[model samples]
Target: MQRRRLLPLLLAAALPLLGGPVAHAQAGRPIKLVVPYPPGGPLDAIARILAEKVQPTLGTVIVENRPGAGGNLGADAVAKAAPDGHSIVMGAVATHAINPWLYAKLPYDPVRDFAPITLVARVPNVLVLNVETADKLQIRSVADLVSYARKNPGRLNYGSGGNGSAGHLAGEMFKAQAKVSLVHIPYAGAAPAQLGLLGGQVDLNFDNLAAAAANIRAGKLKALAVTTAQRSAAMPELPTLAESGLPGLVVDTWFGLFAPARTPAESVQQLNAAFTAALNAPDVRERLAKFLAEPAPTSPAQFGDFVKAELAKYEKVVKASGVKLD
Candidate 1:
């Protein structure tokens, strides 16, 4: 009788050990989804949505904002964190592609220090002008804007989130490709940059579609063109910058999930599956559309290759723009 009782106790104690990887991941610790930008921005909003959607499959997921150094601070933290898959960063174009070339002495290697899990989404930047300013300048399209800028010769100024941000790079690319001169103004974040545009402090802005969608809808801002090769599904009426006379002006920003380089493949795969499922959920897709973002989940290997291509593409852009940060 004692032996039977002890056997039951032993089996009960051993059950947790035999529960397998998924069970272990669930019971061990909560997963941390680190956002490298401040809260209330599109990145933070997306991260929070993902955390909520994937929590069912991921057990317990939480978002932590560690905004600084143009998203490098949070990315570096993940790169150096324990490779146990409990911690991951929501890596963006700024962190992985632009920062590598922009910063002279980056604390971490974008390709070497992290493992790409799955790309969350891709959002194009829109060339948005203040509604009142657009009306005043009669800038109805990219062509009109370019002509005006050429005629004004540095009279028109554009605002961006920061120096090396996607918006800034887009403005530089536009200046080069369109052969126009517009003074560049860098703000603390996209929100402030948009504020500058709305308040007439800046004439125009190159902002993420998701960040500017609401304002565009409300007529506070006029989106002249999307900085992508193709038009966005959420706003199909908007034309692409290429179609608007600048052929090679594509600046679509992407966000993805990344873990430490040494994180187990199994763990990475599990994470990819969970995030992919969450991204594909009908409700999640609807929410992403509200922000003008498109779901673009990819396998780990595919995502890795995509990141490489992005880095290579941005290398040329950064070099041509002559942008570097100390």
Candidate 2:
């Protein structure tokens, strides 16, 4: 009985010699959560927040920014990492879904190179029209937009972040499904594209709901509909595009965590638990809400299935749209 008590005491004393208390941490090494985007973005912010929250359970988590190649750089790095669950990435729809078809020679296969951890959140895209343009065009909803574009082919043009951006693809998908020929004007980035819309350079633009939420509320832009499977809580009054006479149109800027392929199943489960718990924390959700993100915690299997579906969806959309980087 004494030995049992002393054993723990001895181990505690020897902890310093074994390289401090962290030696007994949950992780053998500090976990690396790579953000496939530049610092100061929502992904990076969320990575930092989750890292801090999970450190108690995961031990010394670190957030790394490895932005480039439209998120392929960081995703590739994580894909090639050892499958120990210590190296993971905060990957977005572009890195895992769109980029595979956008860049012809992608270094890593989204499905084969990584084991999904958990889906962190999804920021929906909204089809918004500049207030002034909407009034002049007399369009109030998605049906009106489609009807106007159909009657006046090529008369309506839209702006997007770039040629293959989610906004661009959304516009293309709308055109294909709605059978309209609205012109597309690619801008340097979403900001510039939004600016163009504001300046009436383009009649409308599909944009990340979070990015456009402020303007929508302020009445600078008229949000016709969201591009998510369901309506967003941030704007419950707005309907989804699926409800707006287009069931085939569903798009969202989704992101999630992933580990290298072949990571131990136990490790994946632990990580999923830690992240899902962190995502459910009120503080974490509040922080995400500030960025207009909706926390969508999902099990590993669910995330994997969702990713596969997104891959198939984007493949169809990209091929049909014919937008490729390489």
Candidate 3:
């Protein structure tokens, strides 16, 4: 009789141990989705969109902004969270791939400390030249740009957000792969970098297509190519650098969902199903299209493999650049 009476109490305590979010979910607790950036960013907007989309299946998903240390703070919080589905992070390329090399001390192992749910989206970075500069230099395509850089050596310059930023690294990769010499100009952020390119202070820039779209449309910027494995749906007409000349010059500013490592496989699958379903929704697709983000939902295993590959790829790029941050 005593054993039977203790059974309920024991099970209740064991529930969390058995499954993190699974138990909390049964208890009507909402899942917490951490966005490691500012509130107005694309990641935050996507988190809110997916959260609402998945609420029908996963209950409430609270988006907590824990921005700091270039996304390390929020990712670490999720990495250290109980191996439950209740807490997950919208981790990106910086937090997963670049930070491992950029930051001397990362708070968590991006691969070992987290369980990948699914890749949410990939925002392709594009190579663009100032309209006047492109015309002046007679540079219209990647081939033209590379040829000019090769002939002119350090006469050409590209602007980026800062040292070790996506644009900077992309430029470094391009220089190495193309065997060209181009000076790098680091600006305060992407906006400043765009401004520099527009003002012709810089010859070119690798910026997100969405951010550069308005200028490109207004004829102020000439987009050469995108840096994605495939052409971005946002601008299918624009060729990828890989297609243009550099076959392996693929770079994407991507983000995905991740839970604490050792999370129950069942819970992970549940979360994946919910999120993937949300991503597949037509309405969600239309909304993400507006942001110029390409939704890419993958199985957990596939996402894990992709992350590992990205990590390995960036290791070489970061090491070659020799740029380190605290």
Could you say which candidate leads in TM-score? 3
Cα lDDT listed for each candidate = 0.89, 0.89, 0.91
Error of 3 at 124 (Å): 1.2
| Poorest stretch of ten by lDDT in candidate 2 | 18-27
Which residues of candidate 1, in runs, are more than 4 Å off?
Answer: 1-21, 25-27
Top-lDDT structure, candidate number = 3
Clash counts per candidate, in order, are: 0, 0, 0
Q: What digit string (tens of lDDT, one per residue) describes model 3 on residues 205-293?
A: 99988799889888999999999999888788999898898989999899999999999897898899889989999999999988899
Tens-place lDDT digits, model 1, residues 1-326: 89989997886576444423455453568888899988987778989999898776777788999998989999999999999888999999989999999999999999999999999999988999988889988999999999999998999999998888888888888998998989999998778999999999999999888778888999999899999889999789999998998997789989999999999887788889889999999999999887778899999999999999999988988898787899
Evaluated at residue 59, the lDDT of candidate 1 is: 75
* Better model by lDDT: candidate 1 vs candidate 3: 3
Error of 2 at 115 (Å): 0.6
RMSD of 3: 2.5
List, residue by residue over 27-124, the lDDT tens digit for candidate 2.
35788889988898877888898999987766888899998899999999999999976799999999999999999899999999999989999998
lDDT of 1 at 229: 86
Q: Against the hidden reference, what TM-scores do the models get?
A: 0.88, 0.92, 0.94
Q: Cα miss at 76, model 3 (Å)?
A: 0.8
Model 3, position 134: C-alpha lDDT score: 90
